[model samples]
Target: MPRTNRNGADTKFRAFSDQTRLRILHLLRAGELCVNDLVEIINVPQPTASRHLAYLRRSELVITRKKGSWTYYALAPAANAFHKTLLECLGQCFDEVPEIQKDARRASKLKQQGGCCPR
Candidate 1:
């Protein structure tokens, strides 16, 4: 059981180690976003975006909420001191990264346009 928990933590940290996943996390900092919005903002194919989201879900770093036909993803609530600090660090550290910045801009535009996915 101890080993299982440790592996879970390892998976969480590993999720942060990917550039695409990190960009996805950075975007989630804004609020919950549907997969379509994520694909549009990150300029990735649906499969690629969904793959990253699945990784985050496996790591327990994100939670999903279904709203009608669209599912939205958001950062999971901090589970412990470590998780809290990691999320805080993610928000502070990646806010300035060029790629993340570009993602944020695109996300903002998408939101302003009332989202890319149809209701």
Candidate 2:
């Protein structure tokens, strides 16, 4: 199979197709988070959270960095107008989603408590 274009909508849409991936993306709209934070906020297993995050990384929708032994993730900055619009839409589309809203609340509280990893 041919490699999907990182900038192509097909790759991104495929990544976004999963409900877990969407929840992760929605939570990331706020700021950077650690894998542990995502596991806690999204209430998923660590491997499951890592799997979705890897998909997002392949889709080029999220970026990562390291601080000590922890990896942090954040929504990647838009690389084009299409990506810009998609990210904008992502923010607006999920406000009324109860599951994501609950994730957001938990994420907020986690942040206030200094998160699951050191900054």
The lDDT leader among the candidates is 2
36-62 per-residue lDDT for model 2 (tens digits): 999999899999999999989988999
Candidate 2 TM-score, true structure as reference: 0.93
The root-mean-square deviation over C-alpha atoms between each candidate and the true structure, in angstroms, is: 2.1, 1.4
- Where model 1 places Cα greater than 4 Å from the true spot, the runs are 1-3
TM-score of each: 0.91, 0.93
What TM-score does candidate 1 get on C-alpha atoms? 0.91
Off by over 4 Å in 2: 1-3
Q: Model 2 residue 27 lDDT?
A: 90
Error of 1 at 58 (Å): 1.2
Query: Lowest-scoring 10 consecutive residues by lDDT in candidate 1?
Result: 1-10
- Please give the distance, in angstroms, between residue 62's alpha carbon in candidate 1 and its true position after superposition: 0.4
Candidate 1 clash figure, as a count: 0
Number of the top-ranking candidate, with TM-score as the measure: 2
Across residues 1-119, which tens digit of lDDT does each residue of candidate 1 receive? 55566326687788999988999988998889999999999889999999999989888899999878889999999888888888999988878888988998899888889997664
